[model samples]
Target: MLVLVFGYLFGGAMTVPGGGDYREFLLPGMFAMTMLFGLESTVLAVTADTARGVTDRFRSLPIASSAVLGGRAVADVIDSTLRLVVVLLCGLVVGWRWHDGLGAAAAAVALLLLLRFAFIWVGVYLGLLLKTPESAAMVQILVWPVGFLSNAFVAPETMPAPLALIAEWNPMSATAAAARERFGNPGWGEQSWAAQHAVAMAVGWPVLLSAVFIPLSLRRYRHLSR
Candidate 1:
């Protein structure tokens, strides 16, 4: 909420390169950003559980280890969905509307949630690895760079060639660009392969991230018992 207000306050001067309303461009990116922000809370929750011995207690139970992580993932999904809803309503209040059909809008929402789902494992891994609130708080330092380095607030065209290339290829950029395309909003205005294939990248990035992190998380969890 605070972030959305802050965006609205300063988003006026942010001109889209191809000439479109900044709000339209800002909202879809905001949706993706909202999912990214959930990482902090997920980390905090897991670290808190570990710090308080709650995770150990869970491990002692007859439940499978996967169930323990799965439960956290489910809880985070609900939380992410609620956050998305609030932001969506807030976007509507600010006069941002999806110009695409309902089906496309639904796909956009699915992609946003999928992004969140993939990040859940990341948070779980970090939270378990960190195992303390102090360490988990460092995720905050990581979050801003990951969030802002993408094409969320402004287009990649507004950035230098090198920075623009990075922004264009950011996972968040894929999701943001895909969401914008799905919602029929303005995009980063790049003819590059990444920009043009946003949807595929959007799906692939999360899958790839999950593939890498899920194993790391499971391995980290196993080591926790050592």
Candidate 2:
């Protein structure tokens, strides 16, 4: 809500290049942002379990190792879905409407959830790796740069050419651009390859991240005994 308030307060002065309502552009990015922020909570949750020896207890049970991590992933995804819904409602209340059909809007939402799911593994790995709950603060601090470095609050075009390229390639940027495309909202619409193929990049980024992180998480989980 604080982000929304600040966004609106400053949004009036911003203009989306290629012409579209800033709120419309901002809201989709906000959806992606909400999902990105979930990384912090997931890290904290897993870290807390590790700190309290809850994970150790689970490891002692005769359950499949995968279940331990899977359970956490399930709960986080549910929480992320609820967060997404609340943000959607808030976006509506604030006058950000999707121009696309319901089908497109639903697809956009699916993409958002997928992004969250991928990040969950990242959080899980980090949680297992960090020695203490206090260390989760590192991930929290890192989230902001990841969130803002994208085309979430402002278009990448407004950034320096090199920085804009990096932002355009950011997973968050791809998701935001893809979500905007799905909602029939405006985007940076830059000529860069990433900007032109937002949906592909959006889908690809998460899948790729998961591919790398899922194994790392499982490996890390297995080696916790070490």
Candidate 3:
């Protein structure tokens, strides 16, 4: 609710330091960022289970270790999809619309869900590695920096050179930028490769994250002793 309100109020009051339609540009970015919030659901679930010895009890069972993680993944996807519906309705209430055809809109939805899927593995891995629920909770602070460093609420070029470079290349930026393009919303009028190739990067970021985190998470899950 706070995020949706900030997107509407801030997007309404601020221009992109240029002539771009801030609210329209901001809506898709907010959509992508909102999907990322599912990280907490996965993290907290895993950490609480571990802290309560539920995971240890599951580990002692005869079932495959993969089933535990699979159950969490399935539940998270179902919950995230429901939450996405609410966020989409909120976006519509704020005057955000996709001008593109249904195919493009569907593609945007896939990318957003894929991004959430990839982040789930990341949170799972973190939860398995952390010593306590408190430590796992602290990991959430990393999400704020990760979300803000991207071109979600502002154009990367507007930042200082060092920060701008980081922002332009942030994986979240690709998904948000791709979302704006696919949704036919206003975008930064830049011609850089990152700006021009948002869709590919967005697709690649999730794939890369999943590739790296899946094995790590499963391995950590199997190593319950660690």
Regions more than 4 Å wrong, model 1: 6-14
What TM-score, computed on C-alpha atoms, does each candidate reach? 0.94, 0.96, 0.93
Per-candidate count of clashing residue pairs (backbone under 3 Å): 0, 0, 0
Q: How accurate is candidate 1 locally (lDDT)?
A: 0.89
lDDT values of the candidates?
A: 0.89, 0.90, 0.84
Report the Cα lDDT for residue 22, model 3.
83
lDDT of 2 by residue, 102-215 (tens): 999999999999999999999999999994799999996879989999999877888998888889899999999999999998887788889999999989999999999888
- Candidate 1's displacement at residue 195, Å, is 0.5
Worst 10 residues of 3 by lDDT: 12-21
C-alpha lDDT (0 to 100) for residue 223 of candidate 1: 74
Evaluated against the true structure, the overall lDDT of model 2 is 0.90
Write candidate 3's Cα lDDT for 1-226 as tens digits: 7766876777777676546668788878887887777787688889889989999999999988778888888788888888888888898897778889989988888888888889988889988887477777687698888889989877888889898888888888999999888888888865678878999999999899999998998999898795
Regions of model 2 farther than 4 Å from truth: 7-13
Question: Which candidate has the top score in lDDT?
Answer: 2
Backbone clashes in model 1, listed as residue pairs:
none
Write one digit per residue (lDDT tens) for candidate 1, span 114-208: 99999999999999988998888799898898899898887787788888888989999999999999999887688889999999999999999
